[model samples]
Target chain A: MTVQDIGFGTASAQPLPAQKGPVTAARQRRTWTIYAAMCVAGLLPTLLGASASLQAAGIGLWLPGAGFLSVGGWAAVLFPLTLALFVFSLVAWFWAGMVLGPVIVWLGSAALAGAMAGDTVWAGGPYAAAFATAGIGYAFHRRNVRLRDAALAKIAPRVAFLDASLAEVRAQAAEIPDPATREMTPTDLAALRYLLDRALQPVTEWGGFDIIDQFQPAALRYQLNHMGFALGIAQTAYVPNFHGYMGQAQRNLIDKYLLRKVWGYWVYESCWGHLNFTNWDPAARDNIMLTGWFGMHVGQYMLASGDRRYLEPGSLTFRLNAKTAYVHDFNTIIGSVKTNYDSAEFGLFACEPNWIYPICNHYGLASLAVQDAVTGSDNVRRYAPGWFKMLNQEFTDEAGSIIGLRSQHTGMPIPFPTGEVAYAAFQNCFAPGSAQQQWAIARREIAPAIHPDANGKMRISLPGKGLDTGNYKSGHTGSFASILVAAKEFGDAYVAEAAQNSLDSDCGLEIRDGVRRYTGGSNDTNTYAILGQLMQAGDFRRSFTQGPHAPSRTGPVLEAASYPAVLVAQAISDGDNLRLVLYPGAGEGTQTLGLERLQPGRAYTVTGATTDAVTASPDGRAGLDVMLCGRTAVTVTPA
Target chain B: MACCAFAVYLLSQLLWPLRWLRDRLLVAPAVTASASVAWSPASVAAPVARKWRWKPALLLLLAAEVFGLGVAATAASVSAPAQPSVEFLDALHGSICSAVKGSLS
Candidate 1:
């Protein structure tokens, strides 16, 4: 009381309650106690008021309506039910407005009322608002969908091109250190590059497949020839154009050759017609002659692309008895030939169901060789000696040429051309020694038909019977092309030059953009021509004896920004050293060449037209700018 | 029915219009034929036969007939006639009497 009497303010009056511990715990407790008391005092009245209201508003004031329907029994039932339905309808209308946007539901309501009740005046106002809302929403939705679709459409082509290029890069990177494409000589490069360039030209007329079962073998042959060409082109290069053409070849192999639907008519239709042209109509699951070519194409693709994706089980499904049967592996397709090899005929294959064709059997044998190369199988080596014995014993005619066609059932040679020179090179891919022997025999026997033209270029008169030409033909450019290819394989330079010269003269040679092609020839003939040009003894021997051609470990990368359009014969990299043989196809002026897959932090010296020692950039890249023209070889070596 | 169809086929061979009708109607076209079912100039000119074997379809029809006859017999046995036997007989008698009276007059 003495301090309070002297205090001027509340602080001085309260001034100083004695300090409790470090914290005023008692003071905090007292303050909270006070707050609790005040809160209870204020909230108790509100809670009591709410409780009183709950009691007072018990189901709200009773509406001024009857507790039960105040009418007779039927009226009592119907009247309240009607009233309930009315209330429900109103609730549903309000619910619809909440759910479906106020304006959209109004349109629905207006449409229904106008149509059902003929309430035209009530419909107009709501209908207008609803339509406006719907139109705006639809426009927005359409625009969003279009924008999304357009984005996808714009990205698709670029992605596809990039994907193909990346696959090609991966394929190149996967190659082992074996017979590299760059190991080929200058002659080899010229021939293979030229043939590949020709082979990549779009096959305009594939001859329709619809006529295949009509005994029209030309259409089927056309597709097979292209298949062979596509496989051949895949061996040396993975250029985008050549790689893209493989799709067509794959389609022909699967859809046309392996597809039973295309060949199914032989089962029921021919039985009705009582017509049998060949054994091709029968649905034999393990027919070697008909199916072996497909195996060859697939094996070659495996060897070329270094992609074993197709070798997985069930990658190919075939129909037997109009039901699908899984083709498990490349071995399975190749084994079709191995399993069905005519043990009785000594490894001969049937051309049709019951008829054996020595030439077609050669393809089957070649297919086996391809299988051996791709899978490390010893089929060709295992069967070759036995096959030669059987072939010589049963299939060869008196002239030391294979009999063209023989009936497997009768064991009698059908009166066919027996043998021809055009097929000798084909056998070289599988049995080179036997093929060389065969070609020698054919050359000696057919020497009488070989005549020197006025220009001294040797031309052979083709016996039109076997090669599917009309009559005994003269000036057979296709035969010349075939002979040229065989001659090259056998290393008969004299014969090859003559044949090449004759073909150039007779078939109307066309060379533009460094691509050589015969302008006036059927697709089959042109394909043979390309094959003839590309065939080299080294490539053939390596492929037949060894496994597939191993691409280089690293290669010169074209700087895409300032890349010149050039025909690259071979781009090879060996231990960070790049060697390139390229000829300008459409490109001119100076071009920049970059080295890819080089060792990082290594310096490289580029030699050819210019020599410069340069260190690889952080991304393992080193490049030189140079001027190039026809057929220049560039080498880059690490310093 | 198959026997009748075969008999009809035999008759059709002798009559030109019936033969045409038989090919057009009785014989079904070949299914899954690579070539057309109808004769072409090339096929007609060639030695290869282009005839359809219609006997299989006829045999199928015969099997259907046997099954149909069995079903008809089973259905007939399971239910009585719509009218009672006595009523049926009375109706038959009245119809006979009317026919006889008309003939006599």
Candidate 2:
């Protein structure tokens, strides 16, 4: 009959009325009034049932503000737009299914569950059915909206260059001979395997907190990830080939150790969309932070699977958006260490999640993969953490040292048993200018007046005592002498030889060890892994200075870096100082990467051929770009 | 439940072969260390009870000293500052050093 006639409302019992004559006219008015009141009350079940379903249809449309304009802006600009698109597509599928399927069957399958759960107990089947369909539909709709936004986000400028590098890198990877047989040099794979063994020893006996005091298996897990991040290669990807299948034991260790710590670290960094991330790990947080590319490690995660989901525009946009939101709300997302302190003692890291350093590695990887997928470039990426260009200009000296920008200046105090006071803003580091960006187009000579301790150990400390400028936070004390050794070894044999000669000068104690040097920058273990990564990128070395690097107290590198002729002339010509650069202009066929006994003091020439390799002449009479070769790197001093 | 699991895990470190090793090999030789703590807490003075925060652990280190084993454990895991495992080892060495110093003093 009528809407209210269907008895939608709660019916209250009074008395049934029987009215007929004018004497009962008063009773007739009373019956009519009761009907009106009943209609209003009965409207409840219908209104209550409809509101939830209405809300469900608007699912991810929920946001901070409530306005058509605000919702439109977010839909227009927010990240992971692909997610939003997918959500819409999903919603469409559900709508189609709803139209085709039997209403009774669909409602029975869906609405019955809610009815049994008392969610829609008093409501009838139609209301329950409507609510259920609308709720599920809303979920898909919201997801699609977010994904669509992601499709429109823009890549930063530095990230663009890194994308270019990825193309070059892919071409290079193809050139590498897989087998170590038949004149093929062994790739870094072997070195990596050997590294994993020594690194993965049980932490039970670890002298520090890793094994004994409040031991977090995650500490080691983070260390492993840190190693991978530093080394620029996730060993876990190649684990199957190197080790056996990852059984339960290994998986458990990874889950317990590595995954858990990352979760905790993520929680701290995310700030739960509640607190500031500044309250988290001191090592990774930036004071005035900005857009974070470091979080895009999702790319490296799914690369081996070739799934591309992790590398998709949706993922990148979400990561970048989360970074942007956090940075905007809290501090500008810059690298943490403008200055530094001793959080390491407190088992806290000094490095921040800010992208000044290794985020470049992640960005470089992402841009490379994305470009290949989207635009089809085979180039490797040259990721540049955006902070360096801005901060160095503001805080660094002509020498690029920022001692004035330490934690002490801002008075972010640190707890101490030592006499010195440590503030949060002030970092206590023993080294200045440890990490070297490879982008040094210009050459500058830096020679600090450092001296050896009574034990003959000299520590080059920038000593955060006076650094109150940019980010002089004494975070990480980095030394990539070994990494430099690897690059110099690969780039120019002379560089390796020179590095060896420098190491030889340390004599009985410090011989040529592994590919890592002593680093007290972040966690020692994590730094070790990072040190390995830096070896690949050699994060510390700029190009050669205009003049030779003169050691503060004339250390071993001075003697080792001398000319080949200088070493042999003193041996043979009996003191005729000579200088010569070995010709490596020969073809890759003849220019031997690994060979022994390159005679110094003799004549040598280099011939140029296709594909970039070096050639050696028997006599050094005439040569093409012959500077130093083989044993002459450290042996030849700079002119 | 998580605390119980973690406790079981830590407790397992002290049982069986490790305990035996601590007693026989590591704890035997360091007679000098055990003798240092032979007296009661009041006689030694300065907050002896307070010093025993992680007593079971410090006890293992102490008991191992009597068998000459903690040194082996120490030597087995000590890493140089110049190498890759320095971070893991540095904290380890600090704890070991503290344990040793606490017992010795």
Q: Give the winner by lDDT.
A: 1
For model 1, how big is the CA root-mean-square deviation? 36.7
What's the DockQ for every one of the candidates?
Answer: 0.01, 0.01
Residue-wise C-alpha lDDT for candidate 1, range A153-176, written one tens digit per residue = 533333233334324323422333
| Candidate 1: stretches off by over 4 Å | A1-217, A220-290, A316-328, A342-346, A418-423, A461-475, A512-515, A544-564, A573-576, A587-628, B1-105
Candidate 1 CAPRI classification by DockQ: incorrect
Question: What's the i-RMS of each model?
Answer: 24.9, 24.5
Off by over 4 Å in 2: A1-194, A198-222, A229-258, A262-298, A301-389, A392-395, A398-639, B1-105
User: TM-score of model 1's chain A, to 2 decimals?
Assistant: 0.56
TM-score of each: 0.50, 0.28
Q: Considering the true interface contacts (CA pairs under 8 Å between chains A and B), give the fraction that model 2 also has.
A: 0.00
Q: By TM-score, how accurate is candidate 2?
A: 0.28
